[model samples]
Target: MTVQKTEWPDSLWRSTAEPLRDFPELQEDIETDLLIIGAGYTGLSTALHAADAIEQIVILDQAQPGWGCSGRNGGQVHGQWKPDLAALQRLYPGSQFDAFIKTLGDAVELVFDLVDQHQIDCQAQRAGSIIAGKGGKAVRYLTEWSKFWAETGADVRLLDKHASTDLIGTSHYDRSMFDRRGGSVQPLAYCQGLARACHERGVTIHGDSRAVRISQNGNSWRVFTAHGSVKCERLVLATNGYTDELWPGLAQTIVPVASMLTATAPLPDAVVSTLLPQRQPVAEYAGVPAYYRVDETNRLVFGWRGTVSGEIGSLNTAHLRSRAVRLFPQIA
Candidate 1:
């Protein structure tokens, strides 16, 4: 059950200059205390946290580590829950939502702490994040959201139209909210760092390994691949959007979405000094929000939501570039 290989994007931070490399394929049978299916952020973080406690741990990836979204994210490490506070309060009510929010905040701290402790060197910056407003309705929404976040002990400030223009150096946004809890990262490097840490902790990482067939053998489960099979007591399905065909109906509830990004040649230091001078990342509140950031080399990397066809193979870079120019006409 060999899987076709796909070329990963050449990340500025994860290319040859970086010290991490892809792991070898699984050639022999293996047994472990825990087996992690995906090598993305969630799976890698889980493995890293449990590495000290678990003696035998195995991480398997159909592709390589950081090949998926873990390497290809906007890298905005925002400490906010997926479901909004209102929705969480409505569903779980009272302390449940509060506890969830607190947990998410703690997770954000844990990510930074891990990076500092491991010395990941992923160009992590603790600047902040800006949610820019496009109109009057946007202003109202940001104001309300800022109030909600403030209640949760978040350091969020609502910037008026004038203040927003002054802060972002553009009149495109009518207002904005600044949240200090979020930051940017070189996502690919971060994932590679996690892989290295896992390896150092004696975690067996197998790349280019695809699980073609999975079956329950009485009390134990068998995960079959082309070269070998893993018979384990427990199995974790951590393949987010890429969990297709491996397990039937496993991703039925998740609507896989695609996003497109484009990077320009390294910008001049003068341009970087003037634009996003504070090194903070910016994202809009449009139906399809656009995110932009400056990499360590000062290159402008931007991306947006792509067409939703249940799957994404190739991305439309041209469209994303056009949007980038629209946002920062000076760069055009």
Candidate 2:
């Protein structure tokens, strides 16, 4: 028999991120208060919160910590995916919508607080985020969106065509909005920092430990692995998109969508000054949204929702490089 090892991309945060050296195999059976199945942001964040309350919590991951989307995300903490507040109000009526919005705002704050308290040197920046509109229809849509966000008491300022050009130094967009609420960070580094913090707080993190099968005992659950098993009172399935065969029906609900990104060698100071004068992260609304931001080293990193097919793998750098050049011809 042979074991296949998974590989991760060479992200910018790979060097500075906290390293989780291999852990010894689970030789004997173990019982814990909670068994978390995944080592990404959600799993680790849940572990960090539940660590103080429970007596024992075990986090199981097939790969290394932060090996999934948690480490590979665009790092921008934007508002809800559904931009329409009215639809949200109608769907989650009463105080639910308000509570949801408040919770999102709190989530943004919590990310920053964790970075600060744990002293995570993840290049966390709060310069802000921009949503630019490329054409006539897009400009009108952005205008409506600005008005809608304003009604919800969100701090967003609509930039006219001239103003948008002045800000971005590109005449491609007719208008835009600056959302001061959210910003960007080195996502992988942040995840690694959270994992380290959880470990320091006595959370048992098992890496390279894939949950092969799961069974239900009388009242509890047992997770079987290639090396060992974990018997626990409660189980949390935090493996988003990349969920395995251990949990039935859980994987069907989540569509494992793939996204692609590219990072250029640090841009010239002059080009940076013109493109992103304020150094704010910019994202445009398209069928596939175009997201780009300047990192701490002033490198332009861009990504978008990738076309899904059969298998997911590392994105093509040449394709992404061409896209970047298309967006900023001057850079080419």
Candidate 3:
């Protein structure tokens, strides 16, 4: 896979995120108790958790923190797995399933807790999440989905057509499941905040220090980069979708899919007043896969699958624009 450059991409998140402090490139050979490759959420979160236990920890990334999917993703903090409750019960079995469900439910709360504890200013909002649907099939699925979560003490409700229309400012969806547990955030800012917390906790982070190779060195593992090498008793590979050949078969284990997003300029007051006035993040299962949420500036950021090549142009974003227009013609 081609490595991304050190420069950040032209994204709505990058344009709005708070400036991140620069980390130096690794230059000299070093040794640490733990070495994490990748500065995204996984790596940063791990480093933060391990800081109190481990004496020495180092994080290495090819680019600045939050320069990949962690920063570029849709900032929807939603819970619940893809499988339904029945399937999960069969898969996990008895008390294991209950523990799993509790974990899933607490996951969203954990995000807010971290934000409060670390004081991350990523525009964290707990307004709620709406999964809109249409037709009888969607209605049946969402009804069951809402019941499954509500039984576990989730603040969720099923909205009828009239209620869904009033909440979403569109009549496209006749039914929707609203859960108070989910919300939105400025993804890049959140990542930056995590990095800041890790930095303040004395977790050494090196940008532009891509791990090129890894090998077992007796009882320890040594990782090689362009300029330096690190030897650590514990090593973590947190490179998510950007996984490369550094670990041989690691990249092949997961298929990477490209996603694209486009944001409209801040809308007129009249349009903003009616378009997602509640400031809820929304996902639609009734049509093509799409998710959208309004930002602090009132721009509606819409996202969907992109081309396999990951190219961005008018041709690629036309669908996103059309969907937005269809939902709220007043914007056009």
Best by lDDT: 3
Task: Please provide TM-scores, in order, for all candidate models, with all chains considered together.
Answer: 0.91, 0.90, 0.93
Those runs of model 3 whose alpha carbons end farther than 4 Å from true positions after fitting are: 1-5, 90-95, 306-315
Candidate 1, 51-143: lDDT as tens digits: 777777788898888888888877777665334446677987888876877886787688788889888878888887888868776777788
- The most accurate candidate by TM-score is 3
2 in model 3: Cα distance from truth in Å? Answer: 19
Any runs in candidate 2 off by more than 4 Å, and if so which?
1-6, 16-20, 307-315
Alpha-carbon shift of residue 287 in model 2 (angstroms): 1.1
Q: Which pairs of residues clash in candidate 1, taking residues 3 or more apart in a chain or in different chains? A: none
Candidate 3 residue-wise lDDT, 129-184, digit = tens: 89888888788878898988788777999899999999989999879999988998
Candidate 1's TM-score reads 0.91
Worst 10 contiguous positions by lDDT, candidate 2: 306-315
* lDDT of the candidates, in the order given: 0.78, 0.79, 0.86
Better of 2 and 3 by TM-score: 3
TM-score, ranked from best to worst: 3, 1, 2
